[model samples]
Each structure stands twice: as structure tokens, then as C-alpha cells.
Target: MQTDSKTIYTPFVRAKDSVWEVMSDVLLALIPCAVISYFAYGEAPLFVMFVAVISAMVGEFIFAGIFLKKWNTLLDGSAIVTAILLAFTLAPFTPWYVVAFGSAMAVIFGKILWGGLGRNMFNPALVGREFMTVFFPLVMTSRTIWYNKDYVNFQDLNIFNFLGNGGFTEYMNSIFFKPSGAIGEYSVLLLVLGGLYLLLRRRISWHIPFGLLVTFFILLQIFAFKDIKFSLGGILLGTLFMATDMPSSASTKMGKLYYGAMIGLVAMLCLLNDVKYEYMSYSILLVNGFVIPINWVFKPKVWGENINLKERVGAGVLLTIGIVATTYALVYLHHFDLVRYLIFAYILIVIGRFSFSKQLH
Candidate 1:
């Protein structure tokens, strides 16, 4: 008699939680914010959310099927999350076509084109928002929009007035009942509540958010001392929603703190330079591009591993070089218009090579 036995896979142990489970938890957390947005901004917010979410899902399906030849990833729910986030970053009166286009860019370039879910280097929603802000600034920062019209008088509302005086209550009421910003950004109370729920569920770590808030508060106090209220708004929205993104963020504990701090500092700089619209998203995207390098510098040590003096020195040298190169590149690009196209082309080639090289490995 012959027995038909199959070999078991290594350890055969499955995790209690899965990607879909975590995605579900994130979606649940956003429900309060979504409901709050509808009440605060009326039907427009809901309409944009619907259009964005559906477009993102459909874009992912079509792109994955045509390019990757594997279409089963739609069930992962990542596209939905990206859609919600992108919608949150949009102005309340954004057109349906713009929503659709942004969602497609997010799912395609930000996610699928980078080799799908886990391999994406930047947050998909942020990428979409940044793209829209660059190409369709008028649509994204429309002064004629209903929400913008309401907040028009408070355009220069500062932190001292918001917190020091009787402005706290007024600020709270504005954010809660009559928000005048992006759909999700209108309700700080709801977003905070959602973030707290995620914290309780251990769906997200606190280091990034905490660091971001602290750094942002301190920096605004020093730099734009008068605009603390404006700074606070950016801090809350970016920290709780954007900067806390897991995959696009650093993995190590120290790396998260550094990443958050970087975001805060960049945000302050943007404010100082008069970058008025979606500066938080821009700062977060700028930091996201450095996540890999940050991880490399802050990688966790192996158990029983020893650090050599030479290795430490080499790391310091590499870090210094990276900083200098980045600073020089920024300065050069800012001052020189003639070499901009050439530099852009070169950077694109380098990025393409790096991406393809990763695939080969």
C-alpha cells in the first residue's frame, strides 16, 4: 500500500491579522471623519469621495490587469484608502473629472507603476495631490469655492489669536461645525478621534504623530510665531493622516522620529517661503522620498551584532555627503534655469535605473 503524503510548508503558521484586516481597521477609523465631512460641507464632499474611491478602484483594476497581468489585487482595499486620502486633500468643490484623474494617477504612478502595494516608495494619495496641485492649481485652490469663500476673511488667522485669546473656542467651532478647508481637514476633532481609535487598536505607532506635533508646534513658535493657528491646522492634518502612513514611512523607531521631524521642519520652511496651498502634503511627499535613505541610516542592529569604528565613520561620511549633495542640488535648481531640463532628464534616468535594478534583484 502506498500512502499519498504531501510535505508541509515551513512552519505553516499564519498571522492572525492580514493586510485586508488592517485596511479594514483604517477604513473604520475614517468613518467618523467621512460623516463629519458630509455634515460640514454638504453633498459636495460626499460626491467627491464617491467619485475618487470608485475611480481609484477602477484604475487599479484596469492598470493591474493590463500591465501586470494579475487583477486580484482590487480586494486589498488599498486603492480605497488612497482614494479617501486623496479626496480628503482636495478642495470641497473639486470637479469630478479632476477627482477621477487624481485617483488614476495615484493608483497607477504612485502605486502600480512602482511595482504595487509593498514596493511603492511614496504615499499614493500624496503623489496624486501633489500632481494636481502642480498642474491644476486653479482647481485645487479655487478662491471661488464655497469653503474658501467662507474662510476668506480668516485667510491670515494666526495661532496667537487662535489659542492665546478666546480664539480656541472659535477655532474649535470652526473646525467642528463650519470647517472652511479641505473636506477632511475641516474637522480636527473627528480626525483626532479617529487617530486615537487607531492608536487604541495598535493599528499605528505614536512616534511619528507625536514627533510631528511637537516639532511643528516648536518650529512655528520660533519661525511664524503669529501664524500658530494656521501651523496647528497643518500639523494636525498631516500628522494624524499623512505622515503616519506606514509603508511610505520609516520602519525603525528612531527613523520615524527623524522622518517626522524632517516633515515638520520642511513644512515650516514652506510656510516661511509663502507656499500657501497644501504645503503639508508637499512637505510629507518631500520627506517620503527620503524614507529609504533614512531607513538605511537608522537600520536596526542585529542581535549580538557589533559596531566597528570604521563602519560608524563611513556612515557619518555618507550622511554628510548626502546632505551636501541635496542642498547643492536644490540651490543649483533654484538659481539655474538653463540646466533645469538636463538635470531633470538625468534624475529621471537615474530613477528609472534604480527602479529596474531593484526588480532584477
Candidate 2:
């Protein structure tokens, strides 16, 4: 009855050129954002790109071979995709050090530590984004990469000032690429073009990106339509191309839609609640974490196990107790922070609940 937890039997190996196809598509997908950032932000955007790609690939190779004891499939291109996507989410003009740090997070911490390549539970890009946000809150939240057109043509002065204490309003006219966050990410146009190229190439499914973009646009129109930086095109460019490409995310049609919709909805909520960081990279990662089980469960299953009446009633009662306790705590504490500790505990009960309703694999 017992089977190996780590065993992964696949009908198809990911294909030899599949890696290249995916990587190339991702690159093309990222192009629009890159170009947009370049036109708006300036030269610094490119540096972040370099840092992200180089560091992530290098990390992937090291972990895949020495750490994970695997062969040189660096050509597979997943690492490259992760790196580029990480770059796309960051502000274009961040300190090279910030990008360097994020690259390490995406590489060593994000993908490698989680078992490398396909086994990862969270989106590597969001790992990088979250790492930056948590450690360097001041730098990450300052909108440093957001370029202002007023400083356009005066590249040096504007770039430096933007580096220092530039105002988001001061550079409204410069548009997406002038010099905003995470190097190439500022240019919605460049990013969108890249996304289109990827779709054309069939590197990734349209479901995730399309779902994310469509949901986010609906949210953006109501919440951020008037905001200069958070317009329709820009939000679509970032979420559709950048966040949704995260490999660890859901792959099934229904799973992808729900996953992306959660991301879009949470991002809108984060914005509405005045939380910073565009597109909710961390939130995307969070949703991706929960989507793995969803995908597995959504797959057609062979029946084996059946629930007993006693177990069913017990589960229902415990779930009710858990829900009531959570509710009362939330209402009493006036905040959800009190329940953060309950999540892991709830994970087990939730798993038990789902397991009770399903047949064994």
C-alpha cells in the first residue's frame, strides 16, 4: 500500500528542445517589459537583467549537479526563465546589490532548496521579490525605479535623483520605461511584446497568463485605472507575462484560472489595503504554494478508499470547531495575525478533510 513520496513517473520527458523553447519564449515574452523599462528608466535596467540571469543560472547548475546530484541540463532553460522573470518583477533601477541579493534568493533559496526544477512548491521569482521586500523594505518600497519624464534627457541628474529620493509624481510624463523598478520591468510595452512572442512560440500555456491578465485588468480598472503607474496595460504586462510564468504555479486549466484569479484578487486587495509592491509577487508565490495540491486533486483519480461514518462526523465537527475558533479569534483580536499560527495546524485538518472526501492514490 505504501509508495515512494519522491517518485515521479512521467509519461513524457520534458523534451530535449522543450527547455530551449520555453526559455526562448520566456525571453521573447519579457522583451516588451525590458524595452519599456529601457525607454523610461535608462541604462541601469540592463544591469539588473544581467545580474538576475547570470546569478540564477549559475546557482541552478551548481545545485542541480553538486547539491541535487543531477546532470547538466542547464540547457533545459528553467533557471534562465526564473531569472528573467525575477528581473521583470523588480524595479529597473534598483541597486545592483539588491538585484544581486534577489538573484541569490531565487537561485539558492527559491528553487534549489525546494528540491530544484520541477519539485519546487513556490514560485522562484516571488521568492526573490519577497526576499527583497522583507530585508530592504526601505529601498524596495521607495519606487526608486519608477522614472519621471521631467528628468528625461537629463539622464544623469534624474537617474541619480531617482536613486536618492525621487517622487513618483515628479516623473509622470516619462512613462513606463524611463527608470522605474527592477530594471526592465517598468516597460509594459516591452514586457507585453515578450509575452506575445512566447505565446506565439508555445513555450507556455495561455491559460495562466490570460487568466491572470484578464482578472487583473478587471480589478485594475476599478481600483487603479487613474493611477499613472498602475494602468491597464502595465498591470496586464506584469501579471500576464511576469508573475504567471512562475513554473511552480498550477498547470491544469481550472487550477491555473483559480490560481491566477486568487493572485489578481489578492493583488487588488493588497493595493486597496495600501500595501506596496506591484502585482503582489509575494502573494503570487503564496497562491502558488497552495495550488500544488489543487492540481493533483483535480486530476482524474482511481478509486480505492472510502470514508467511515465516524471519521466523517469527526471531521465535520472538528472543522466546525476550527472555523468557529478562527472566527472568534479574528473578531476578538480585530486582526488575522493571531491566526497565522493556526494555519499550519489547519493545514493538517484541511488535508484530513480533503482526504476523507477522496479515494487513495
Best by TM-score: 1
How many pairs collide in each candidate, listed in order? Answer: 2, 31
Overall lDDT per candidate, in order of appearance: 0.70, 0.58
Candidate 2: C-alpha lDDT = 0.58
- List where candidate 2 sits over 4 angstroms from the true fold: 1-16, 71-73, 143-182, 219-234, 301-361
Best by lDDT: 1
Model 2: lDDT of residue 69: 72
For model 2, how does the per-residue alpha-carbon lDDT over 1-361 read when each residue is reduced to its tens digit? Answer: 1143322232112556565665676666666566555555556666778888888777777766775677675787777777777777766567777877788777666666555666556667767766676567688767545554553433422333444455663443344344434454344445556666666766556777766767767877776655524444446555665556545666556666766766676566555544434436534655665554545433333367443667545644554354335333433322333333333343365346434544343
In candidate 1, the residue pairs with backbone N, CA or C atoms under 3 Å apart (3 or more residues apart, or in different chains) clash, namely 159-228, 159-229
